[model samples]
Target: MSVTRRVQNTVRALLGLTLAAVPGTAAAAAAPEADDSPTSASAGLRDPARKEIAMRLVSSAENSSLEWRKQYRYIEDIGDGRGYTAGIIGFCSGTGDMLELVEHYSSAKPGNVLEKYLPALRKVNGSDSHRGLGSAFVRDWEKAADDRDFREAQDHERDRVYFDPAVRRAQQDGLGALGQFVYYDAMVMHGAGGPDGFDAIRRAALEKAASPARGGDQGTYLNAFLDVRRKTMKREAAHEDTSRIDTAQRDFVRAGNFDLRTPLTWKVYGDGYRVD
Candidate 1:
């Protein structure tokens, strides 16, 4: 067997999530079509309007509001152990993404307000220690957020580190607009490594159902993917809220709205939101 197959089998066994009812496997299936139709491929999250809807959907969960642009200055430690979850995509201080965001920002605009905090951000990397960052750092971050350049940097980094990759992977898997958005949301939250990360969740879902790329039913695969995501969130105290899955994505799947047509309504954290 190939190295990829070996890894998938190992993860499937470790996750113990084999779904016997789902048909086919990566080895047994033909490669998925590049586009289900002309409209589907171009109309996925790559479209500007659809991407805006995705932003609102993610913001509903991340900031508890659909006003994603307002979150450029948002910052706080939610006690998630990642430390200082901030910005539109919730880059964490404990995780390396926040540090990278600052690095990117500094590279773009020299002597920016947040440049001084780089040393502190690096020192606090991998743990929730605020040894070098405190209220002053928060102040500087908020100040930096006001800059148009800084906000643009956050958007660039967000697309670079999360959104673009997720959308590409989803399209490659022959997913539609909704599936593309689903992948983007998962990438925003879980990222792409470790046991509870986006990659692992996808692997577990694959063990239960083949993706559309692998000649599987799109709805079945998406439901399986959401099941893995929900279970993963429940495993963590900070990410235990499954309403994003229970009410939003699953609602879309159940409705067979694979194209993710707008005029949609959903609730997150018990707050209703609409994108028309």
Candidate 2:
């Protein structure tokens, strides 16, 4: 099967296992412990944390996979009076928007494929780049690998963290890549970089998906970077005055330098994504 097709299979398995993955928080309600009680930070939108993470995601590109550069060829142009918003958000926007979209995306259907794979899909975005794709985010997974168990472990974590618990929380709570980015880190926390450690995350994500917290709503969170960009476009539209647009965009140049905080016309959003 194709890699995307394989990813779809993993998504299917996540849906199948939803009831098994959710952890019992009832114990916490009965008698709370330090880790069991959970942090207010775990379930809310923390803006300071979001911004800092955004910067990290953006800066990480220099150290990211080369594959991403090829797949999302346009992402590098962010900033400087052109392109979508730069940094991690730029990458988030690029990845989430670029791929072959999963079906039934709008919270509309029961077997909504978009709702299905979206958790893991959006959750995949914290990468410095997607050049490594699965391996970049998943430690032992190789698109070229022939081992079934190695592939399965990687698939499991992909489903676990991205498809179920983490992605869902991010969508509902409005956190972006901050939590999604942690899954890879979580996998590393297991036994080690070998198959065993990687598979631990896989199993963990699956366990979460199977849990009761999701309540069978089947709703999936879209990485909102694109939505934010849309709003940014609207805001930019209100500010457009043609004369000002031209003046602001062309405010003199250092010859070959880039402006970084470049202003874009509302039209740019439509065109950029089409080209993006």
Candidate 3:
């Protein structure tokens, strides 16, 4: 088998072994029925339809397209403080996340293209500088996306670093799919868990209005969250465009899409889309 395929198989086998080693954790419970009611007890984004809508919404904002899967090879500085924002969820080379991703990828497949960049990646961590990384770093990152193992690592890291925590917080807040998606998108744009990150924005929003967990109206709570997120974005030059909030997510709120039900249409960066 090819090296990439062997890595993929090994990762799968490890995952299977890990799951098997855990008692009573082999199977997940059946998902709850979908409910659009703001105060419904079954509110969550676990359903496949809701998950797809959430993914599309984020893609529209981040990539200006609904094809988020195609963004694995995306890499650029974009003048953001974080250097080398790349991959599916914009892991930054400067912030140590890109190094972690490369490490994970290399663990699965030694001698991979990114493996040689470990020293540079580690040196560049925690700062916004490409001093150690040259043009070849960008080329290698894009090339690595062609490998299935690399793509899987990116997906896993995106979930572990951003998606899962955001969704979990939203569920704890008694939020539906829309609210969960709001948190997920914010975490993607902002640092996932930091002093000035999504949690900070969420806390500020909570001060203004109660979350659904505290019996607040879902629409009102989400509006508060978006309001905070917009302010946060405007504070940073790289994220000044508030269309993702004002147009895309707020449009759903206006349409009463708390459940994120599809046949949905929205716009980001003045580009329109329909996800039916």
Candidate 4:
């Protein structure tokens, strides 16, 4: 079967297991732990500690800063064929997601600065064109970043588009915060749920190792996933630096940190970072 078909089958199987009444099934075995640490009281990486670590990782890759909050106003056309890579999660204007974020922001705060560019945003969706956008759009996006509502809208859209689905898939696969963060990071860099995206990387990893949901070792499976992610990164010039996987996530897996606990230390792009 095709990779996309396999991913769909995997998700369907997982969802079925989650709804199944069978004893000792994958769903029953993959339940998330209760909140004992500073993290949230649910499954996946939604907890505060895990979320903070994730933000730092993304920031290290995108902005070289641990203060991910500072990237709210970050906007630029990096000539990557994806127009206007901006915001905390690097929402691309060409992907229609950025337009969706602006829509949400406008809904929350009417007559926002970006509201004027709705026509241009629609035109530029799925293409590398800044035809109707220029310095003013950049300035307004930066200005919008100053608003709490705008920031919240960005956060909501990031979660809705990337973070939540990645975490859900990891949970279904019986993976922990590390694995969930792996999925999230992949989704952030390469859009989620597509054939050449996160699901393909995951399916490739599954071919090499069994998932925790399939009664495999979590760390081993994650290492396999990172290996595939590294290969995928090397295929593109912009993502050629595989240190984020080799030095960062791989370090966590080497240390047997499947749960992605705190006091974490790693390097991305040759810069040292620590999170406690």
Which prediction has the highest TM-score against the true structure?
1
Candidate 3 ranges beyond 4 A from true positions: 1-43
Taking the tens digit of each residue's C-alpha lDDT, what string does model 2 give over 96-157?
33122222122223442223334554544432333423323222112212333323333343
User: What Cα-based lDDT does every candidate model obtain?
Assistant: 0.76, 0.26, 0.72, 0.74
* lDDT of candidate 1 over 1-276, digit per residue (tens): 000011111111111232111112111112223445544536788878778778877876776656678778877776667778778788889988999999999999989999888999999999888778889888989999989999999999899999999989898889998899999899888888888888898899989999999999999999999998998888876677787788788888877778777556676555555554
**C-alpha positional error of residue 140 in candidate 1 after TM-score superposition, expressed in Å:** 0.8
**Per-residue lDDT of model 4, residues 1-276, tens digit only:** 000111111111111321211222111112233437544425458876668778776676666656678778878887778888888888888987899999888888889889989999999998889999988899999998998999999899988998899999999999888889888888888776566588899999999999999999998899888888888877877787776787778877777767776556666555565554
Q: Hey, what RMSD does candidate 4 come out at?
A: 12.0
Which parts of model 2 have CA positions greater than 4 angstroms off? Answer: 1-48, 54-58, 61-96, 99-180, 184-201, 204-276
Number of colliding residue pairs in each model: 0, 19, 0, 2
Span of ten consecutive residues with least summed lDDT in model 3: 1-10
Query: How many clashes does the backbone of model 4 have?
Result: 2
**Candidate 1 least-lDDT 10 residues:** 1-10
Q: How should the candidates be ordered by TM-score, best one leading?
A: 1, 4, 3, 2
Tens digit per residue, CA lDDT, model 3, 156-187:
88778878899999999988888888898888
Runs off by more than 4 Å, candidate 4: 1-43
